[model samples]
Target: MSLTADPPSGAVPATGGTLTHNLVNSGAEKVVFKVRSSNNNEYRVKPVFGFVEPSGTTSLEITRLAGPAKEDKIVVQFAPSPADAPSASSAFNAVQPTGNVTIPISAT
Candidate 1:
């Protein structure tokens, strides 16, 4: 999967705020992306998993719920969609995990 995240990093209010990351897919095939955070207890991510068509783009919203606003990271796991898969989300059923892209997060 030829994927990348922009802004490299994100900033939110130390007290509590929301941050968003844009993911660009430049590959030739569709990809299923699973989003997660290093600290799930302190943060919430939307669209935990989804799919992106080739040359398409999608956004992930990472909102800091409550914490000291320390540095954290978001993990974006991606795998190519299988031809027979009913949906992109099912791609995660891959026999093995493929790749991941990490995005740094911090409180402003």
Candidate 2:
């Protein structure tokens, strides 16, 4: 799992900013992410937090996608999303693509 901040570059914790985590296949070959809302009084003034599934094998990194209300700083957790699409109520799981796929990440 990888942790990343918005602007796809330097660190800038402000409103409408972003943080990203990349999950690539290794020996495990699968991973998941858990994001906690930074929606505190401080963040309330500048609310922003989101995540995206990494789909490539390039150097791991996190960047932001197109959306309203960007996030700057973000806390991230890694686990598994799912190999197959399952119900939201089911346990978390994520599938690692068989080949190279670059999953661009952003705050959506």
Candidate 3:
């Protein structure tokens, strides 16, 4: 499994920029994926939690809630089922046998 985001980190424009992230699951079993911003007040993530079928792919979008911000961090994590209990809250809170990825965002 892997997670990636475009424009990893940079200054935020006056109109803000849309962050596009992709998550890929190559395992044979289903897995759960989650996305969260270190500072929710500054950044927003949609469909915070969802499932990724085996050999499937998913995408997420993060948008700046306010006009601009100094910096922020977005986390994308995945946890395989059975071994790691599932949760509706966050993947960070769950046991990540599959590890995670963090992307940084900053403002100009």
Q: What order do candidates take by TM-score, descending?
A: 1, 3, 2
Check candidate 1 and list the clashing pairs.
Answer: none
Segments in model 3 whose C-alpha atoms lie over 4 Å from true places:
1-14, 82-98
Instruction: Compare the candidates by TM-score and give the number of the best one.
Output: 1
Where model 2 places Cα greater than 4 Å from the true spot, the runs are: 1-10, 13-28, 37-73, 85-90, 93-108
Error of 1 at 20 (Å): 1.6
Error of 3 at 103 (Å): 1.6
TM-score of each: 0.89, 0.32, 0.68
Candidate 3: give its CA RMSD in angstroms: 3.6
lDDT of 3 by residue, 1-108 (tens): 444444455445536666666666777877776776787776777768876667777777777755654767788777765445455454435555476767877755
Query: lDDT by residue for model 2 over 45-91, one digit each (tens)?
Result: 12122123454332333333333444344344444445564442242
Query: Which clashing pairs does model 3 show?
Result: none
- Global lDDT for candidate 3? 0.66
Q: What lDDT score is found at residue 101 in candidate 3?
A: 67
User: Candidate 1's error at 74, in angstroms?
Assistant: 0.3
> Which has the greatest lDDT?
1
